[model samples]
Target: MKEICIVEFPSNLGLKEPQPGKEPGVKKLPDWLWKHNLHKAISHNILRLDPPKYSNSKDVETQILNANSLVEYAREQAYLINNLLTQNKFPFILGGDCSILLGTAIALKQKGNYGLFYLDGHTDFMNISLSETGGVGGMAASIVTGNGHEKLTNILNLSPYIKEENLWCVGNREYDDEYENEIRNSSATYLSLHELRKQGISNSVKSFLQEVETKNLDGFWLHIDVDVLNDSIMPCVDSRTPDGLTYNEFNELTSYLFQGNKLSGLEITILDPDLDTTGEYTKNFVTNLTSTFNTFKNTIN
Candidate 1:
């Protein structure tokens, strides 16, 4: 067992608010407000990394022209993370969005092959050609898998930062049929909520573990997005889905993953406090998450 540490990231995609839908429309907030308020609101349990603001923060352009700026940003964060990983600390990150996974994942690639226990509602495998929507969040996973956007793919000087064969997506329930098929074809594995409900968390955990052990993976990483939880439990996500994992179910899964002790890193993404109503979502989010880390800490210590 290893110690778990949190690394904070500050990034607000400066877009506009999305239209109401489960396939989330993009929403933009003032970057400064997001950094000062929303980013500040995340828990302080883990090591906090300083947020990066580029010279172009004030300039206006698509995330494309600014891709170089992002690459620079990724490099800096990657350096900090690689240094820490060498010290044998488990790196957990609070994200601007799931895209932050690219930088952190890149930093750990040198550790040899690792598995991804990806939890998300959307497949995020679309490229410029496949994406019906132009939102970067929708394409972030594909980007990390070396599917789209050179600026993103080139960041931290790595391509296909995560191996698709070792990546498994769990709890994703909402998706277009075409995209669902795409996930089936991709190197990744998809375990939906229906499967989870039918098979039970322990059974699902056992299934994932059996595959990993049989394949002989070097390590595993857990990437969690709040959207994986039901809209009833986590409504502050970028997009809210009506049906998903319950709190007890998600916590049970979390405890099992922690207890497994094969985790190389943990990354929590897609928390939007602005989208939250009474902060109940944020409270539960942090409380459930921190309690998880605490339990892991106690066991390891």
Candidate 2:
């Protein structure tokens, strides 16, 4: 439906800097995606941004690693996205982690309130105290919805980057006792993996879209954490959960989403190329992604 431009962020501050001697594969995603000719296969025009400087420092108060750097980086990212949208181009953001969703949401919030379609293995709704690692990635969804540290929630003095009713979280398979309570109390609509299977993927998505339509919002952002795929096929994530969608299922869901013109942009996150030693996963990912985009193009025409 719209011309696509790939945006790459090679920083991993959101997930915390890679431990010494261990590579943070998420930071290398841009290179891996480009190596596999993702740009060539998906779109003719590609835009690459310089990666933000890596920082391992943490805020003593919030226990969020690289909090300062993350704020600055998200601000810069929002600027870039705003510029792209002003040009009337759809951005396909290749992220370092789900924290990039903060930048995208800020950009959209500047224009108006918009919806979010989050597809991830984990709900990412943990608060600072409950989060095991205190990484922003784990708390990104909560932070964007104005539930976390003030520094993140009040970015640019705009809190609650997205409205609760406009947010739809899907494919989340991991949740603990506290998180379950959080979800129950949260205003955001959540579709767990179990419910998604029971209701059927197509029906689940259609139902979400129906709610989105009723909201009468500007548009929505699509976020995909690769861990949403089956662990057997995609084990490259930092945390792996059991029972995810098959490649065919992912493609079908993506194609259905793309068929709609309401999507303002899309972001793909949590893909660690370092784990794919054989490159089979990357190959399969590229194939599915390309096919999905092509399906969208066909629908638009």
Candidate 3:
């Protein structure tokens, strides 16, 4: 398989802190993954970016904490991604939260129009008014599609970081009633967890890829928020939900996604090591991720 570049992003500004000492668990993700040797498993040419310091303060206008900071960080991330792409390197971005999607989307937009393969537990379509906690991570999808606050929607003078029809949301289980109309009206295609289970992951993914092919996209970004996995097996996520895919099911899905080499880049987000006191979950995550990369190597080469 081709070698790839790993980018480390360890910021937690997107989520709100519920308590004084209880910060978001994402800040430690990059180090945790490194300590466990994610770089060794994936590639040797790892480019570690210095993430902005964690900021929990909220924006006065948007009411989302670290709204401005996210934009700044995204711009920096865009520059780094642009450089990597220019050098013809595949970036495997290790993210702090789902909100990092903004930076990735912007970087892809800068190069050309690309599609998005979003795998997450929540739809992340909530607008500022609809988000109960005003977490930017919750509205990342909306922001990328030009449906959220103007400040976030228009980053680096790029409006609509990703086109709606080029986006495909998969493995989603959580839905907000208040924003149900907004989500339903979106042009982006969605394959809910129920639908995926009914169709089976392999078939469902094939269908999604076919749709993406019809769009004639430049390339597509694969975003995987670990919360999409079943809470029983993957319990380190901040937004823990029940009844997600098993390790075998997710591995099968990943193998299929990486086989064809249609992906421009990939991002893995939302694994909080703080919650996993025993470190068993991290070990499991490392094993599964390493196995998936190995599958990609065998299939793509």
Candidate 4:
């Protein structure tokens, strides 16, 4: 375990404009979490990688919105993350959107072979044609796994930031056949919400860890999309669905993952404060996350 570095990537450039003239509020996620004191018990070392200006127009070349800017931001982000890794700091990144995984993935690839623990409501394994809004955030899993346009899939000449076999896509509640097939057809392991419950949360986590050790991977990264929580509990995210992981389930899963420290770091993404008109959702989120995080605080300190 090492000291934690809280990196704020407040960029909504990866999502489509929710409204005609309005941008997604995901960029405010880090601040909202901070406003609720998510950092109170967590580390105080914070860094902000502000994104380039957000745009509504999709790139004609890639047909993904803000493709060029996203690549640029990811490179800068990798620079910061590289520094944190060099300092032996565990990066607890607060993201603007799931697409932030691009930067994190690139950063990890620079070091060595790493695995990905993708926890999200949707598979996010979409390509431009499959994405209705052309939001890169929606295709995060695909890009990181080198399944999308070369521009995003290839960063620093490190295509496939994470090898498919070393990846685990979990907590997907979206029942889209095409989306599910994207990851399912790949070598990456997929565990839908239903499958996770059926097999038991702890069992699912243990299985992933077993694979991590088996591969002798340098380390692995955790990407958590708040939408993985039950819609009844976490409805502030852009894509809301029905039943998902409960608070207790989330805590139990993370507690297991954080044990023994093979994990490189973790990131939280796609929680929209605008949708949570009342801060209740954000507050509850902060409470649960910080509580879970604090359990491992001593090891890092």
Candidate 5:
């Protein structure tokens, strides 16, 4: 079987404090997944990228929390992922938050034109002016698409890591009629949770893959935020919404995405271990996800 390297990226530098003095617990994600046997159930080749100190202070210049640190982290992350790709190993990244997308964006941009399959509960397409919180986590989609502050959008002098037309923002259920206009008006394809259900999960992924083929792009990246799961099943994330895809639908989506040849790598993000004190939700997540990944690997072999 071809290798799939599990990368542990535990950086919470992109989010604001959920309360007065507590940092986000998303940094504990890798450890939590490991305890649940995520590694044992899959490939044992794992690499970890230690994140900088978590800071809640927003940057004066960029107006986003830990913007400078995020930039530095992005470069480091890109270097690691680039190395993995060179070795023909598929990188399965475990993220600290949605902010990790910036690093993957940089790595993919360096290679060639790439598309993005963004699965999240919220658009996360907020810019500095539209964001109520100065969290870069909220602005990741905007930054990667070159719509935010230049420092983040232009990491390593490469701006717009992923082109707007190449992105497909899916599974978003945060139906803010006002704030959602930004993405709705953008060139990137938008498929809300309801629309996805109506279009059929398999059909949605097929359409995205068809676009990748139509563009004749090198490949694409997959970003899965756990909050994309229905809130009842996945409320551990810092940001939550009332609606999302179910585990069955999520499994089908993964199966179809994995069937495609153009998927370069994938990142799983925004699952908080702190909230699942009993570890029930994490175990359920690990079981469902690992099964999907293993099934895909078996098929490829």
Candidate 6:
């Protein structure tokens, strides 16, 4: 365990729609959560980052768009994460959206060779032609691995930031048919939601860990997309679904990462405050996550 640095992704990329618009999965935080007092309650040590407002300045409605300044902005975040980790701090990135992961992942790689475990319901493997919907965020994974647009992959001088062979998608429940064939043909490995529910998250992570240990990776980055949790319990996420991990199931999976010291940094995204009914969803999520990291806070201190 190490000190946790929390970063905030202030950019919305025009994803905050009133009713499932381009900001398809974006939600505004309740005024209460944004209150300074609310920030004090979380248990884990955190560092907050705010990217800036008005990120999607070129065209909010463009189907295939990449943030013009994402690369520079990502580098800023990378710089902070690197400096903190050098000081023995565990940096946790809280997203304006999952797009922030591109920056976070790149920053962690600068540290050394590390296995990338991208936990999301969608493969995020879609490109412009392949994406059912042409949202740039949908192409995040592809963008980072050099599979999508060059402008994005080349952002922050992070071309091929993550080698596809080393990237593993965990709990991909909303698989598009096109992505399925691609996954089968690709070098990346997958542990489906069905497989996880059957074998348990611990078992799945163990398998992945064994592979990493055998290969002698530098460390590992753990990225958690809120969509991985079932919408029944976590309704505030951008992409809500009926079938996903329960809160307890998610807690179990995450606790193991902390206990083993496998997770170096984290990024949580797609939480919009505008859509919340009572602010219960995001509050509960942050609460549970803090509890898991606090169990061994003494080790870090």
Candidate models: Cα lDDT each: 0.65, 0.82, 0.82, 0.89, 0.89, 0.66
C-alpha lDDT of residue 54 in model 4: 93
Candidate 6, 109-222: lDDT as tens digits:
677767778788777766667754455556676666777666667765667777777777778787556766656566778677887788778888787777778778777777
- lDDT (10s digit) by residue, model 4, range 167-277: 899999888788788888999999999999999998899898888898899888999999999999999989889999899999999888877358889999999999998
What TM-score quantifies how close candidate 6 is to the native fold?
0.85
Error of 2 at 73 (Å): 0.4
Q: Give the clash count for model 3.
A: 0
| 10 residues in a row with least lDDT, candidate 4 | 292-301
TM-score per candidate, chains pooled: 0.81, 0.95, 0.95, 0.98, 0.98, 0.85
Distance from true location, Cα of 3 in model 2, Å: 1.9
Off by over 4 Å in 1: 14-47, 50-66, 154-157, 299-301
Q: Compare candidates 1 and 4 on TM-score and give the better one.
A: 4
What TM-score should be assigned to candidate 5? 0.98
lDDT: the better of candidates 1 and 2? 2
Q: Alpha carbon lDDT of residue 106, candidate 1? A: 77
Could you give the C-alpha RMSD of every candidate to the true structure, in order shown?
Answer: 5.1, 1.6, 1.7, 1.1, 1.1, 3.3
In the range 1-301, model 2's lDDT, one tens digit per residue, is: 4667889877677775456645467988878888888878877677666556666667887789778888898898889998888777788888778888888889989878788888898888777888766688888788888888888898999888998777778888885667766765899888888888898889988877777688788888889999999999898988888899898888988887887667788998988888887778987888888877875764531
For candidate 1, give the lDDT of residue 110: 61
Worst 10 residues of 1 by lDDT: 21-30
Residue lDDT tens for model 3, 45-97: 87776666666777887788788888898999899998887776788889788
* Residue lDDT tens for model 5, 1-301: 4588899999888888889899999999999999999989877899999888888888999778888899899999999998887787788899899999999899999988999999988888887998877988887888899998798999888898999999899988988887789899999999999999999897889999999999999888889999999899998999877978899999999888877787888898999998999999999999999898887774431
